[model samples]
Target: MIERRLFEFHFANGDKNGVYHAVYAYRNPDGGFGHGMEPDTASPESQPLFSIMALETLDEVGYLTKEIILNDFMPYFQSVTTEKGGIPWMFRPKSDYPCEGHFKTVKEWAALSTTAPLLGILEKYEIDIPWMKKAEQFVWSEFERIKDKHVFCYLCVPRWLTFLKYTKNQDKAEETINNLKKWILVDGIVCKDKADEGWGLYGKPHSLNYATSPESILHSLFNKETITSDLKELVNKQKDDGRWDTWYGISEGTKLEWAGIQTLWALKVLNNYGEIEK
Candidate 1:
């Protein structure tokens, strides 16, 4: 019932209050959220990665107000952002906090995964702060720098596309998307050895389609047939208990949070595709 209520309030009723209560439990006192909201990292300390999740959730619920963005969230982000204006992948608390084994951040480096979604959140809320302009620069530069490289990041693609989708710079957005397509499709990252292989964009759990709901820009990279197939896969993965299982092995408490998050994502994808009654 709790999971149903959470999904229905978020997907059908547009209930900001319900979503807020669900999200706020993880918020830290310092205005960022980190208390294992990600399930991989169990620290109450504010993390850029988890903060992006919280902000994106708020935006999804239409609760990302200017006041909250500028006053509450931006300050913590400003404190953590690199001199180059890009936020790090994470900033773990110095104090003793619960952390999974092998927990680490990029440490003094900007990460596209964290920075792009944060940019998307700012764009969604229409907050044109000065830092955003700098972040925009970083996103493009990083895209160009890594586009031709042998490496690719499936997790960051959706987030980067989200930022591009709402970006005011249409020309730049188009250019960046073109580059991404080359890296993902033309360069063989989408289906490297075979479909569903390691790091191939679509096959993995929480892949591009799973992360990016109502995926429009990526239609070229992932065809309608593929999208439909992936959608069916998502449906098939739902458990008998009505919650989708997470791929991670974590503590029981964090496991519950991760399952809830994954369930929310699955419902969002279903609701986006007309599978849920609006």
Candidate 2:
């Protein structure tokens, strides 16, 4: 099944010989950062900016390589990361170079879930890079110092999952996730009164971005097999694509990246406990 899916993404759209397999839109070699898809795209920035979740999908699909996966992917990734002293949250393809700390905002859902997704991928890829240590330390240190802040909810959730996935520090992982649970109001819902809730590192997703997001931390908990039955409503929200939305917006629609992080989280939760919608 995985193999068939792999061919679909890696070769299905290409010629039978698979001559130009590196058609990833974000990597259009010219695709400016627009809609995560570029047509005749080119920019002076030359940075292949990608969401961490997006990279995970590619690697999980077994398509990442030195050629397609830029050696500078991490550098560009770090350019937006704090450890690299980045002020740019994202880059504009129109610019000559990626802006350090340039992003004006980290979207609500992304604010909560993006880092851990990157951390997981970085941990897996760091074996080859080693230079990513600085960014790792920077994020880890900040995570430890201000953990109690509601905004720290985003960091801790994915960080816990990253550790669970990459490190053998089961105790630490469990502890982090447990502590993060304090902010969740499971029996109720976040309201307009606390709408300014900074659940993510930055404020976001209106109500869904914070400690309250039933879907946000649910995956991390499921990965550890620590919380079962509490995630039915979350899991049932998965799309038919064997993945869940990265962030859903019915008005503008959603950008359901359908990445592996979601799939892994859903699978672990459902497999251990039972499918939700069944």
| Number of the top TM-score candidate | 1
C-alpha TM-score for every candidate: 0.81, 0.48
User: Candidate 1's residue-wise lDDT over 1-278, tens digit each?
Assistant: 23444676765674677777777787888888877777677667778887887777777667778888898788988888888779888765565666766565446478877887888777877878788988888987887787755325555666877788888888989987777666556534444232333322224432334235555676656656666766776677678999877645567887777678668767877877777764
Candidate 2 error regions (>4 Å): 1-23, 28-34, 37-49, 65-72, 78-88, 91-116, 125-128, 148-156, 168-174, 185-278
Compute the lDDT for candidate 1: 0.70
Whole-model lDDT, model 2: 0.41
Error of 2 at 173 (Å): 4.0
Model 2 per-residue lDDT tens digits across residues 157-264: 543455446644457666766765554434232232322322111333223333233355443423332233234444555568666545322222223332443454
Residue pairs that clash (backbone atoms under 3 angstroms), model 1: none
